[model samples]
Target: MALKETRRPSIFWLMAWVCFGLLGGSVKFRVAHPERIPERGAFVIAPNHYSEIDPVIVGMMLYRLGRIPRFLTKASLFKIPVVGWFLRRSGQVPVERAGSAAAKGPSPLAAAREIARAERIVVVYPEGTLTRDPDMWPMRGKNGAARIALEQGIPVIPVAHWGTQALMGRYAKKINLLRRHPIDFAIGKPVDLSEFEGKPIDQHLLADATEKIMGAITAELEKLRGDKAPAHRWDPSLHGQSETGRIEP
Candidate 1:
């Protein structure tokens, strides 16, 4: 028999915000530049994916900042136990990374296109998974965000989040109430991808663009956390430090 899918229901956002509020995770957001995004249209909020709870933290921040977003999550996450139910109830979109060719399910790109033509927002984590880096530095991301941004003429807003990893760990599992750390988010001005609208999304171009976005996000995180910039080649193994140390910024 085919496996059933899990998703987040529309009310998930409401419940998630309440849960976080009760848990004491502070939510702060600032939109320094709104011109980056169009006055009123579909746009992409591309952020670095660092922990499991990142969606909730970032999603709530977006909502509080006056934008309701449709988040793209992993298909496998929708098959979990109770969590799966909550995801579906929250109206989250589940994406199949593998066997995606079988059928065109609700892809992030599709959601982005819809956002471009609709009134809602789409939250896409370019980095498909949590960062393996101990410092939580963003790894190389996929081309999904770039493709949607260029193809649909939508603005790309880069969001940076910090502190959620402490509550959920690098690889999110159960809640870490013991840590009880505070989290913060910073939203950068939207980026215009019209220059590459029609050009092929080559690896070099995509990588460069993704790197630029990640860099901006990391910088914001650093500013918020009062941390120094990480070395361009920040390999913990080379320095004999644990991967967790590099995760802060």
Candidate 2:
């Protein structure tokens, strides 16, 4: 099933599709269980983030599935001139630091409310940034995706993709697109949060929900890559690595 388009594609999205379409020609997108995405309405997509190019791949994959894609973009990007104009016009949500309530940007719930105002897919990286895993496994999830879902009463769909690291390493400054890349996206069903339906939003509850969301995505990634993930998800705090910036593992 494909997501139902509720509105016409804006000029930015139209151009974005054409641009990403050309980029996709050089990279093969092998999608599995795309039917997991709902045919209508706004829903959160929780995907593992390992490479800087991951967002492009996810956006391309969603558009291929008949859905217009949006993202929780960094607030700094919105401060730029031309790129910011495109991002705002394209309807991407802006956040200071995703999933952080104390951060000095727009509220996370406000981002969710904005997402609910439309019918597009919002791709959220629960890890908040590139994974610090030495092997690029999914790391500990932030509460942004879960907090958004719970605040706005939307589904959190767990998705995972592999092979982008081969296109470009985690902290590498260069991206090699000379060779055709085969990237696989495994879209899992919406994570069930029935247990937390009426509970007051709290740090404990958000952490648990984030765990389930990340677990579902990790499971999907394991299936796509056919490799077992680490027994414990990587935590930057434990490894003395900065949480929001590049850290070689």
Candidate 3:
């Protein structure tokens, strides 16, 4: 696919520097196969979510690649002061959670489709939120990315990252910068959803495609960590967790 031509607002660079300053000193970051990221086209950049810092790390990676990282953020975040201003000004899309009366607006997925159609990169956490897996491996993903890929006919690039958890544990209120952690990112080739492209977008189809996306991410994570993933992916529901990606105490 040819790269699309688009203009990134100044806020994108502003956020880039902010993220860099925040993370640069604390961790050694490396990205593999960054070339796999399409230089000029609309594609889904799906990465496993394990920490609050994942976006900052991944955003830096994409920014360095000359792609403006547009995220599908939670709508509530857009209500914050400085953070919200940055998210909206930088072209990030806001998504409302299910059954929230405050979610009065266009669907976030729809906004994502618009961004992709413009030939821009859209970063999506297929896991939806941070991984609930105690081992930090990616859990079963939602169908949002899969549906977008199939419905929009855009590519879905699976990226696996490790070490962010060490920098900041999941949902922990404080960050540990006691030691410099190495944040490793492995970018896989675009998932082959060609077979499902023309098929009807259904629950079964979305589930199947989402599995492939998460599977690719897991495979790369295994390479980065040199560790084996669980025999079966974890489902938060079965583990007494909520769909919000939180592990219940």
Quote each prediction's TM-score.
0.73, 0.90, 0.92
Q: In what order do the candidates fall by lDDT, top score first?
A: 3, 2, 1
- Alpha-carbon lDDT, every model: 0.64, 0.82, 0.85
**Model 3: ten consecutive residues of lowest lDDT:** 1-10
Query: Distance from true position, residue 146, model 1, in Å?
Result: 1.1
Better of 1 and 2 by lDDT: 2
Model 1 lowest lDDT segment of ten: 1-10
Compared with the true structure, the alpha-carbon lDDT of candidate 1 equals: 0.64
lDDT of 2 by residue, 164-227 (tens): 8878778778877688889888988889988988999999999999999989999999998898
In model 2, the worst 10-residue window by lDDT is 1-10
Mind giving the per-residue lDDT tens digits that candidate 3 earns over 1-249? 222322434877677777777777888878898789887778999999988878978887777777788988888888999989989988898877777543686686898899989888898889888888888899999999999888888999999998888888888778887888898999999999887877778999999999999999999999999999998998988977888845642
lDDT of 1 at 84: 81
How many clashing residue pairs appear in each of the predictions shown?
A: 18, 0, 2
Backbone clash tally for model 2? Answer: 0
